[model samples]
Every structure is written in structure tokens, then in C-alpha cells.
Target: MKYTNPVVKGFYPDPSVCSANGKYYMVCSSFQYFPGVPLFESPDLVNWTQIGYVLTRENQVMLDKINSSGGVFAPTIRYNGGRFYMVTTNDTTRQNFYVYTDDIYGEWSDPVYVDQGGIDPSLFFEDGKTYFMSNGLDDEGRSGVIQCEINIETGEKLSKSICIWQGSGGRYLESPHMYKINGSYYLMAAEGGTEYGHMITYARADSVWGEFVGYAGNPVLTNRNKAPYLIQGIGHGDLIRDKNGDWHILCLGFRQIHMWMPYHNLGREVFLIPVKFSADGWFTAGRDGTAEYEYEIKGDFEQKEKKLYTFKNTSWKIDWCHLRRPDFDNYEFYDDSIVLHGSGITLDDADSPAFIALRQRDFEFELSVRLSVDGGEAGVTCYMCEDEHYDIALRKSPEGTEAVLKLNIGGIKHIENTVELSSDSAVLIVRGDNFRYNFYAASQGSEIYLGSGNTKYLTSEVSGGFTGVMLGLYSIGRNSASFSDFSCNYK
Candidate 1:
């Protein structure tokens, strides 16, 4: 089937998918945030439901002050011999760990340290023998691949490691997955870094251990362009076959505006493309060197209505993740909305701001918040980075119900307007373009302006983090507030 851009959205990076029990299960790298390794299940690959998280207990891994992209790297999920396995690299210790489960949704086993040095570890088993592979920087300052045999029972390495691919281009290589087909072992890997230079490549070996030959078409897929491109940094992929025996490629893609560095907050979006193998055994992505249509899977196709979020739920949908570990004590769920307690810091504070935001993917989207604030300062806002933020806030002023629109663009604050609310409840509407922010309020009619200040500083280029912009409700000062009717729509 032809899948669209961003089959899954919002910061779900380094996706690894496996099929089991007539269903497709996916796990992605959840750096820093606890309850790590999001697990998703789908009857059809197109529509997915978040079932549970893999790391729920303290024994899973020791995570302390893990920064963005600092906790868990790429994770590979595979079901083998009546058990499911998840292998990942922890940057904190630069070591590999493995977790298994009889049931994917049930409690997962505690992480057994593999002592493997490198990022992106994948496991493959054949005929009762298990093999482990990983990729990372080598001794010579180049990215290289390593492999070893692992004892399934004890989760220990049984053989000395061997280096496989030295990588091509100036960029480093990572995220390697090994497969055996037609009596030849193939090692597929992502190279050219994770940014615009990303590319997927493969090599073949007569033996599982060495003498691997690079594919003639070194980079099976890449987005090397001097101008605009459909999908930027298209690599870090996994290949899977459907029940019908057709090959499909699932990889990550990034979308960016002309001047703005593509903020990959939609994270590494899941995209499915068709693949073909030549008689000599090399493979290529896309049918005719082009992306397939959205909704076209290479099997008996079925259409189902996409699920929408409802006001009633214990937590937001699985697609939502926080910039940092969420402080549950500061928020609570009421009838149909979320009540947020104000923090001591303001929105401009670097370390402490009570904001919950998501990625801004599409050019046109609408975010609505039903808010009532008392005491210090609080409201809803769209945050790109520390310096670049736009907020519609309600703070306690000498005048009653002071509602203000403020934008911190490049460390400068521009107050667009301030009005006194007749009642406690008010609505804030934020509309975004490809590269600009448009602000409006329900209390005022027809007066939407290009956020009335310099916003060049809000770009990700200035903010140092492996994240994109997030949009959510936030509170500041000592007072508290409640936000309801929180809804978002994309066009």
C-alpha cells in the first residue's frame, strides 16, 4: 500500500517494526523521557494504536538527567521463538541492553547489559543461534559496524566481534539491520549522518562474519539536493515482507521550510515505500525511483477511518510526548480538560516553564485552548526554542482580566495587545504558516496579525537541542489555571 508522509507523527524517531500474532508492532527511541520505548500495535500498518510502554520500572535502566537524544538511541524490536526482544543503546553509559517478553503488552524483562560498545543494536536468530550487530565510531574516528554471536539463554556474547561496514561519504554510519536472503547475508545501514546527508546503504557477505561487498548503488536512497526536496534525510530504515510476500521499506523522513532548519519534531516519521531486488541481489527503494502514493499498500487494501482524540481520556494519545519528564503533581484531569498549576518561573525561563507542546508539521493548523487563570501569570503558547516563543497569556494585573499577546523573538519581547476579560473563561487561537505565526483571540474579532514582533530568534538554529517546536498549554508564576476544550486541527 502507498503510505503518506508521516504515517506516524510527533517525535517518534528511530522506529523499529515487527509483525507478530497477525498484528504489526512498532517501538521507537524515546530519549530521556521515562516510561521509555513506546509500543504501538496495528491490525493494518496504516492505522496504529499505542498499547503500552516497554520501560515502566526502575530496573529497566538508570536514567538521570538524560538530555534530549541522550538516553535511548535506535531500538530494534523482533519476535523470535515465541518471545519478543528489544535491543537499544544507552548514551549515558554507551552500552547495549536487551529486554524480552512473552507477550508484547505484558511486563517486559529487566534490561540485561550486553556490554557492546556502539549505538543501534539489532538481534537476528537462525536455527537456534542468535547473532548481535551494532554500529558506532571506530578506533580511527570513522563509523563502522560490529557483530558477534550471543547466547540466547544468558544474553552474553559467545564470540569475538568483527567490523563489517566502514561507511561511505564523509558522514558517519549507524542503525544497522542484518538479513539473510537467497543464501547471501545482507547488512543494511543508515549513513551520511542524521541530518540532510542521511542515506540508506547495504552490503552483501558470503559468510555472516566477513568479506562483505558494498552494493553497486552504494546509497540505496538519499535526498541530495541544492534546492527544495520532497523528503529530506530519508534513511534509517527497516525492510519487512507482507503475508503476500511483497517487500516494503519503512524509513524516516523530515520536512522543512526554505530558510528554517527542518525541525524533525514530527520526529522521524514512518514512511512505507516499495522495494525491488535485481537478479544480482542488490535492492532499491521506491518502484521507479519515486515515492509511491499515500494509502497504497502492496496487498489486499482496506480503508479505515483514522482515530481522533476525544476530550475524555486519562492521558493524551500516544502520539503526544513531553519536552522533559512531566511533573504529574502540577497537573490534573477534570471533566474534559486539563488543569495546570503555575510554576514559579515565567515562559522565558530556560529550565522551568510549564509548557506542553507538539511538533508543527503542516503549514496550516489550528490550536484552541479554553483557559481560566488566577493569581500570577498563565496561558497557552507555541514554543520553538528558549528564545523563540509566542504566547497568549492571562496574568494578574492591577486592571482586571489582563489578557496579553506576547512574542519572544530572538530574546526580544513584543506585546501585541492586552485586553481585560469580562469573564474568567477565554479562548486563545494560534494559527501557523510555513514559517510565521498568526495570533488571534476569541474576545477580539477579525484582528489577526503577523505576531507583531521579530521572530527570527525563535528558530531552531539558535536553540541547541535535538527537538522541534512544541505547542501546549502552560502556566507561570505562583497562581494556577485550568484549560479545557483543548483541540487541534490540521489542514
Candidate 2:
């Protein structure tokens, strides 16, 4: 079985993967979010398992006031010798750092700061030497790709940097990767500002540093034509070869409507494509710039269903994460349900008190939650940004058993409907197309439609964020709430 685009859906971008010890480990940028840098493990390149995160402690960074796109940027994962290394840029601090671990599942070393004033640091080890490449603005105020050697032990630059390729087309370029294949060094990077003209380009050189030649087929892979949009704006990719010498490219792309431009979703999602090397030593993704049905792999291992979210056996999946750093004191898991205590701030606050959310993908989807509220305002919400959201809450009102459905469109709050419920537990169902939302509520075996409209209010256009949409359960005020049977289905 072959999966074409979006092997992992919804806001999974800037993928970097490295194979080691008969297994593959991958990581991606989780900007402005907590439990930073999702780590995925895979036996075969097609199937993946979410292992854990790189940043699990508060000491990692101060994210209290981190804005939508002001946290972590692009991250590159590489295996050097016996240690697995991850280098990332903290946009807030404008610093690049490196973290490594001997065992993939073991504790990773604290970030060793590299004083490189650039983003998207990729490490390449060749012939007992390590080289670091990044995208930075040069002396002419022209941002170009650069490469330099670094001391592996201490994250320090050992040589003066050299500019290889200053982007093609008149747009900003970033996300650079250096790989040595058959004695020739190849540099792959993204260009065209990651929007409509976003593309992946390559340049080749005889030496690690020097005159690199950009490919005549500059954008080796892109969706610049009309017709089937299986993948759009595909770039920021990393390439790897299996044991049998078959190559694969893991990149990020987005699915968007015509009104949303090309790459205007929350962020990029993961896409896999087969790769072929030309007789001229150049690599191109897929066949003729399109994805393939199936690719070749060397391994002969039996396929298995990878578990994503069973707390005991598998703690968390790469798909499961919060929008920002979560306050552990606000929530806990018990009796197969996640109980959230009310926080002082409402969902409107940039730093909302308690929210456990997952990325929203697909046009038609359903999210159901069985919630029990005791006091103040507490319930489940489908949020797009800080200002735009829709919630079905069980609140304490003058009426007996008060239930309210509220919509915050562009910072303006509108109560769509309110019903009085006599039951303790209520099942809230939120269904939506890409633009509109329908809210439903059920209690005591009775169901009612709460609200239905073009809730475009809950979109990136109305709300301001670097992400698309998120569905999570939240509680606020002075009391607490319990949420069970939390399920999400996407069609």
C-alpha cells in the first residue's frame, strides 16, 4: 500500500529525518507550541510512530509571550557517528542550538548554543569533519544560503562562511540542507517565500565550499501547473536512501482553497515522494514533478499497525500536541478521561489558561466530547485563533441547567443559542466544512441543534495565527470540568 501526499496530516512542517540502526527517526518544527519538536520513529519509511518530544521541560525556553510564529523555526535531525543530533533556531532569541543523545529514547543533552545568526541549521558530517549550513542575510543585505565547518564537540564555527546560492526568482529563500553523494556535495533549499511560488531547488559543487552550480531544472519539484493538486507548494525537504539504495524525499505541503492562496494554511504538512538520481548526479523528486503510487524500499520486515495514542504503551503521537506551553497544574488524565481545572483567563486571552488541542485537517470532520461541568463556564471549543472561536459550554446561569453555544467572530462574541439541560453530562458535537460550522448538543437522550452558519469567523482570515484550526476541550472561571469520550473523525 502506498500513501502519496500528507503521510502525516495537519500542520506538520519542516520535516527532517535520519536513519540509524535499522530505524528511522524524524522531527519537525512546532513553532510557538510547547512540548516542542515532535519526534517520530519508523521501521519502514512509510509507517511512523510518535516517540516523544525534544523539549519537555520549562527550562527549554521562555514561551510566556511567544507570538504565533515567534517560537521555534525549522529543525534538522542528523545522526553523527553514534549520537543523534538535532539543530534548531529559536526565532525569539535569534540563536541556533544543537541537542544530541546517544540513545534515540534517552534523555537528550541540553541545547548547546551556536552563535550563528541564522535559522534552519543543518549539520553534515563528511570525512571526519562536520559542516553547518544555514540561510542568513549577507553583507549586501541580500539573504543567501551559506555553509561553514563546525567543531562537532563544541557548537562553534571553525571556518569563514561562504555563500553558495542566493535564491532564484525575487523571493526570500530558506531551509538549506547539505548532503555529499558520490564525492559531490548537493545543497537543497526552499525558495519563493513558501506561498504561491514555493519550490525546492538544488545546487551542486565539487568541494564542500565553493562555486556551486544551480540546476537547470531549478525547481526540481513544484506544483506550478493547473489540474490535480495532489501536492501544492512542496518544499523544505530532506532526502534519505534505504538499505537497498532506493531514495525517498520527505517534504512539507498544504491543502488550501482557491481563496486562501497556495500555501496559506496553518503551516506545512508532511508529504512523501520517490526520488531518482540523474546520470548527471542531480536528484529530482517523484516522476516528472508528480507523486508516485508506490516506492521501493530495502527492508523485508512485516508491516504492523502503529499505535499513536495509548498513554501506557505509547505516550503521545506527533499529531497530538497543545498550541502553546501547557500548565501541568491545570489538567490531568484520570479514569480514561482528561479533567481540566478552571483557569483565571478565558479562551480569548493570548495565553489561555488550559487548552488541550490537536491540529485540524480536512474540510468535513467531527469532534465529539462528553463533558461534565460543575460550576462557572466550562466546555469544549473549536478554535481558529486567539480571537475567533466557537464553543458549546455548560455554564451556571439564572436558569436551571444552562447550556450556551457562543461564537467569537473576529474578536466579537455572539451567543448563538442557549438551552437548559437537566442532565449532568452532555455530549457536544462540532461538525464543520472548511468555512462553516454546525454545533450540536445532546443530554438526557435528547439532541438539539445549537448553531449553524458560515463561521468563517473561525478562520485564519478573521483570527490571526500561524496555524489553521484546533479542536480541544477547555475550562475557565473558578471551577473545573471533566471531558470524556473525546473523539475526532475526518472525512
Candidate 3:
């Protein structure tokens, strides 16, 4: 079967995976989103279903007024001794923590904080001892991938943090994961940032505390210079062995809108690449050390792609996320509909507005929703951050209800188009392609064209954030809005 590059899609960046109990479970970074770490389970590596979130309870993590890419950073999920532990860093608070659960389906326990200063934390268990690792400064103030032995029960440091492997001469050396394979301690980390220059570099040592040796041909996997390719930013990978005992790397990458555009609006997504170990115990990844758009693999199950998503098919708890910490009083959820109570909070601020969103999975999609607003404004938004979003809403004015289209790019806010609606309820539609999104309003069996916005404006390249575009249903300004028949069909 031939599987696509991004087995998981849409804003789910910095992926880490571990196999347990005959199944593969994965976690990804969720910056500034309420449910911090998005968790997914897969029967095979290619097909993944989001099971739940790792940070469900408010007490486990903090996101109040955090910047767009501020909260929960890269998360590493590991399974050991009948328990699952997810270790991550809250970049907003500059603290590292881990949450554990014996039952993966059940709610996770409260966080146990580690007095470590770094992001993208990972835990390794060996010889009845737990070793915590992150990319930061050691006790001697040496900058590199740091390691320390810790008490897993209490997160108390049992040994001084020490620098292990520095890297292979790339900038932003981060996302370090320690693996002991074939009795060799292998440390993998990403470098050259998480952008176009991203690459995965590694080194192996005889002991965990190395004297490590960098691979002669470093950057085991990357698509940095594979220009004019849709897949970009290929780094921050976690190694996994499949049911057939073949090794693969589950990493994060983004699809550019165009080959030469160098702009990506769909956020960093998950990609699976084949890895092979040499006779001397060194490994190389992808096709000739680069990730591809698709790969043919030997698997028992077929690779499937989800093309249509609706309220009935998607789980509200697993598929939907809101900005920062949301006020529960602002939202009312039903089986087929959602009612949002608009508050004074708006999308322009860092505060949590009445917004619930799903990640935009692909470049071509048609999003439509039937919305009815009683007083203020409610609509569907293509949201990237506080400053970058496109909204098509039904607002109540003194004259009547009007359909409004707004494009917000950085400091510029423009109402591109509007239509006088005959009724309070209308279907808002947003049709998107690789280049742009077109807005429309439908009422009385007629579709009115609102306007369009360029997709480049909403990309992380232009928006300057670590997230991708989200299709959000939102309301604002002390009103009651009911949304129904919402669907996003991707082609």
C-alpha cells in the first residue's frame, strides 16, 4: 500500500510516538490551546485516529494570556511498565512536567513538575531508573542536549543535569530523544530551527553520558534543500518500530501552498519516513535521506484518507480546540448543533473568545455552516492567530441582519464585502484552494458572493507563529448564536 507523507494533518506539530500493548500511541505539541497535547492512536503507523488529549484538566497546565505560540511545546509520549507518561514543557511558564496514566483511555493524572529549564522534554527508563532529557543549558551552563536522572514518582532530580550531545553544527538544536538500540546509546535531535532549514541530526555513544560521535554524513533526515517540493520543514522526529519490526520516523512537516511560494498555512503536520540501520549500527531515513510525498510500504491494512468531516463524525472533545482557557459558560453543545453565548471578548485580543475550531486539514476544502444570531455577531472564521484571520459572519444592525466578510492581516483590518440579508439565519460558506479562500452567504435559495482573502496572509511565514490555520465557529459581543449543519469537505 502507498501511504501519504502526513499520516496526521493540520497544526499537529512536533510529534512523538511510542508503541504499547500491540498499538501505537502518539502525541503532538498544542501551543496555547486549551487541551494541551493532542493524542492519537493507530492500528498501523499510516492511519491515525485522535483518541483524546493529554492535558485535559486546567490544573495540569496553564494558558492564560499566553502568546500565540507560547504554551505547551513539544511532547514526548512513552510507555513503560503498564503506564503511559507524557512529558512536555509549558513554554509560557518555562517549566517542564510530565503526566501519567495507567489507562490510556482514562483521564491523565495531575502534573508532576521537574525543576528543569528547557523545552521538548523526554523520559527514558532503564535499569529501574528514569533519565529525563531536554535541550537546554546544563548545571555548568553549557548549552546542548542536557540529561539528568530523576525520581519518576516525584520528578525530583536525583543527579545534576549534564550536557550530553551538542549537535552537528546546525542552529536551534532542539527536540532531543534518547534511544538505546542494539546496546548503543543513540541521541536524536533536530537542528536549523523548525522552518525551511529544519533537519534531524544525531550522534551515538557507548554510554548515555557520551563522548559521542556525530554521524559522518549528518542530518539523517531532512527536506530542507528539496526545494520546489510541497513537503518542507522535515525535522523533530521520534523513532518507532512497527509490527513487522521495520523502523520508521514519525516527524512533523508542512505542505507549502505552492512549490515556489515557500508559504505554508496548514501548519506543521505529521509525516512517516522509512528508516534503515546499517551493518555498523548507524541508521538513515527516507528515500536517500529525504522525506517524500508518498511511500509504498508493506502493510496488512489499507491506508485511508478522511475527506469529509461534520459534527456527527468528529468528536467535540478530541477534534475541537479553543483559544487559551475558555469560559464554560460561553458555550452550549448539542449532538447536532452548538450554541455560543457571545461575551465582550473579541478575536482581536489574546483573551478567549467564544470560539471552537478544527484544524484545517488540507489546501482545498469547502466549509459551510448555518448560523442564526439574535443580537450581535456570529460566524465561521479561518483563524491563524489573534492578528491573522478571515471571518464571514451574520451581524445584526439597526437596519437588518447583514452578512459581513472581514480579513485581518497583522495591523490591517478590512471588511472586504457585505450583503444585506433578508433573514436572521443564513448559510455562511468558505471555499478554499491552495492560493486563497472565497466567502459566500446563502439565503432564500440564493448564494451571495462576499469576497476572498489570500491564503499567504494566514500562513505561519507571514503570521510569524508556530500554528496553522483553523476553521473556527465563533461569536462575539453579548449575543446568542446557534450554529447547525456545519461541515468541512476536503478534496
Per-model TM-score on C-alpha atoms: 0.86, 0.91, 0.99
lDDT of each residue in 1-491, candidate 3, tens digit only? 88877899899999999999999999999999988899999988999999999999889999998889999999999998999999999999999999999999999999999988888899999999999999999999999999999999999999999999899999999999989999999999999999999999999999988888999878999998897898999999999999888999999999999988999999999999999999999999998899998887777678888998899898889999999999989999998899999999989889899999999999999999999999889999999999999999999988899999999999589999888989989999999999999999999999999999999999989999899999999999989999999899999
| RMSD (CA, Å), each prediction | 3.5, 3.0, 0.7
| 242-302 per-residue lDDT for model 2 (tens digits) | 7678888888876664444332334467777888898978877876875443455455654
Q: Candidate 2, clashing residue pairs?
A: 266-468
For candidate 3, give the lDDT of residue 254: 94
Q: Local distance difference test, per candidate?
A: 0.70, 0.74, 0.93
| Best-fitting candidate, scored by TM-score | 3
> On a 0 to 100 scale, what is the lDDT of residue 387 in model 1?
60
Looking at candidate 1, the ten consecutive residues that score lowest on lDDT are 447-456
Assess the local accuracy of residue 94 in candidate 2 as a C-alpha lDDT between 0 and 100.
Answer: 88
Off by over 4 Å in 2: 139-142, 227-230, 257-267, 291-319, 453-465
lDDT per residue as tens, model 1, 30-98: 766566788988776777667877877757865654544567778999999889999998877787999
